[model samples]
Target: MMTRAFRTAAVVGAGTIGLSWTALFAAHGLTVRVSDPRPDLDEAVTEALTRYAPHLAARGLDVTGLADRVRIAADVTEAVRDADVVQENGPERAEFKRELFATLTREAPAHALLLSSSSAIPSTAFTAQLPDEAAARVLIGHPFNPPHLLPLVEVVPGARTGEDAVRAAVDFYTSLDRTPVVERVEIPGFVGNRLQNALSREAVSLVQQGVVTPEDLDRIVTDSLGLRWATVGPFLGAHLGGGPGGYRHLVEHIGASMQSLTDGPAPDADAQERLIGAVEKAYGSAPYAELSETRDRRQLAVLDALSETTGTTTPKEEN
Candidate 1:
């Protein structure tokens, strides 16, 4: 693996994801240059960092000099100048990303890893327009929402991407204390989002069928599947659920039942309406800011508990 240590990083985009990344980089003592077109970019980023600073501290990351290390760049080219890695969080349009990656390939340093935070689009979609040499350095380093707190970062490489570039990208994120999973294949949605959406589809179907209220459905997950998955992922959970016989026992006993559920009809238009109405009734009255704060606090508490049980510090402790 590449042992290159990055000192300065560039953030392309000052939106939510970009701002979160900027905060994390600065908190970890990397000089962060952020580029965005927003008129209130500086003010917005400062406010975001201020809000996240305490959370970072709670997770064992020092906030000292964090604000001093972050600067707003005048443009993309300027943002990436003298940087070791470029984390692009620009608009998620195919054409826009294609043009942006091409510009990044031309402007950024040849050795710097060109990483995109694109969720759906693969690296090939943007790197297709670049020459082989430049495209070899471009790939997707897609992070979960609220990346500063979440540990998962999917490192996916395009067909033309070099192994060294992929290794550098993975090492870069691993340095940031992220769980970097190198995807062997470049598929849409990677892995986490696909699993989340699959569960969501079934959850919506259950609610639409009036099998459970929206609140109850959420409660069921939190009390059972969610809690279980937090400790052991689905596959392992199934292996344990099968007792001493393991996964083979699970398949032999419930394979048909699982297959039947998988083959069930997907949610239709009426189901979508019902799901929407149920969700609206449950949370539509609350302000989004309040809900998000609640979510972050709960997530932090869970991480703390997990850390205590696992005898390992949270990712932020690496700082």
Candidate 2:
């Protein structure tokens, strides 16, 4: 399925998230150039790729071949010189992103898809000032951490983003086996992060009020909502709840609850600290490793089952 490589792509920043993006793109048979000014960028990128090799294999990728296609660049200009796409994961600071995007826009191909992996920054804020207003080529391409495992990639267009650029970015990501969700408008935190922070804020409030321990609250999510969320999004889950018709009935009854819960105040500092302490006490020094391992394994099993059920066909060749 589209065995021809993606020609070339670049990953800027080469930090954990940037390296992870490089690994995923390389694993999908793209020739990747990674750039970061950090002194130890090479070592960090290599380490990330090494760790990701087997994970890609588990997801039906050919890691050994993919490794041969990657190149490390010493600077920004070299990285995007011939890149068809650039996934930038620079620091979250607005000025840094603005400067970085401006610089890359100068070197990147006129139509190159410039995607930011920033979790919080709206693409328009950073892209608005580029010469040629090539910021139109820039959009948010937020991938979940260790993107190789997660199929979801949010594609958010900035106010000035060209419609054609957005479409091409979606097509490119889809060709790499990612599920691309097009965000028609830019918003802070996008969708996933916003939902996560909302739940986390409430968890903090509960612990501050002594209504529940951190461990108990974590259990509720891990044991319930998390399971449902694994296969489908909340809206899809609600659509299914409507049974025979899908969404039509559910929206009529429960849409108001969703609206009502939208603007609740976030936790105060005292509540945040108490909850943070509860989490530290509950999980101690080592947190998320065991739980992550468990979740990854379970997710793999689920993928395996779904593959068998659907007849694990190779991706169809994209035109």
Candidate 3:
């Protein structure tokens, strides 16, 4: 067996997020067992890994024989039996997660780290049914979109999650070269998604109000805030924006302007349909494959450029 901090992983779910986790795990030399009830499990994983191979290579990861290290388990129990880490990407509903996690904690090894890729819905909500010992190992390890590419994994512990689990979660994600930020309070949507949702609401409002087309709105953000945030993040960027004064100075000077900006209107069903239509009209013409490929290519370029500036690169594992 391969020796590492966390040698074997069980990825529970085979959707986009689950498959991405599988690719990253196998790329890092962990033996992976993936489970999903979907009939096309084998085909889906094969296609996703094949598509992700080049991007993983560009990120300086050795993906040779990657698929050979991953296996499709017979069931959820089988998937997690001896797992050192269990990453659950199951449905986001609280009820579904409650039942799923109960099974996971019962089956997975006692010392395994149980993580969820849930966008929201705190671990406490679902883990209420679990015993203290089982609940201690489970927490939200939410990743930003496309877990294979993005560098962040928000580590939000449940109310009952032990300190040991919290520290272990951080260490495990760090080993994979992921930036794991722990949220002291487990708020809805956690930090990244809350900020992203706030921005998304305004972006939708802008397109719906005809302030800009969907395509132009994307360009505007990618050229400005998106690029800026990628570099310094929001608060740091604002600190720099303050000239020599820092965030406090910037806020004092532009506080009025910032406060004057009205909150975006909450869209009704009709408005949502229109927003979707507008977005589809703008970029839906392109095939999903083309769009995804273009996105990965550009994102890889940005990551490479950042690596050059920082004099560091992503850690590559021997497979």
- Write down the lDDT that model 2 would get: 0.79
TM-score of candidate 3 to 2 decimals: 0.81
Point out the worst 10-residue segment of candidate 3 by lDDT.
287-296
Cα deviation of 247 in candidate 2 (Å)?
A: 5.1
Runs with alpha carbons beyond 4 Å of true place in candidate 3: 1-4, 263-319
Residue 265 CA error for candidate 2 (Å)?
14
Top candidate by TM-score: 1
lDDT winner between 1 and 3, please give it. 3
Q: Which ranges of candidate 1 are over 4 A from the true structure?
A: 264-319
- How does candidate 3 score on lDDT? 0.85
Tens-place lDDT digits, model 3, residues 251-279: 55885577567566555667645654554
Give me the runs in candidate 2 sitting further than 4 Å from their true place.
Answer: 1-5, 242-319
Q: For this target, which candidate reaches the highest lDDT against the unseen true structure?
A: 3
Q: lDDT of each model, Cα atoms only?
A: 0.84, 0.79, 0.85
* Predicted candidate 1 versus true structure: per-residue lDDT over 1-319, tens digit per residue: 4398899999999899999999999989999999999999999999999999998898899999899999999999999988899999999898999998888888888888899999988989777768899999999999998999999999999999999988898889988999999998988888888999899999999999999999999989976777666655665556555555555566668866776766676557676456545544655565555554554455556777867977977554222
Model 2 clash tally? 0
Cα lDDT of candidate 1 equals: 0.84
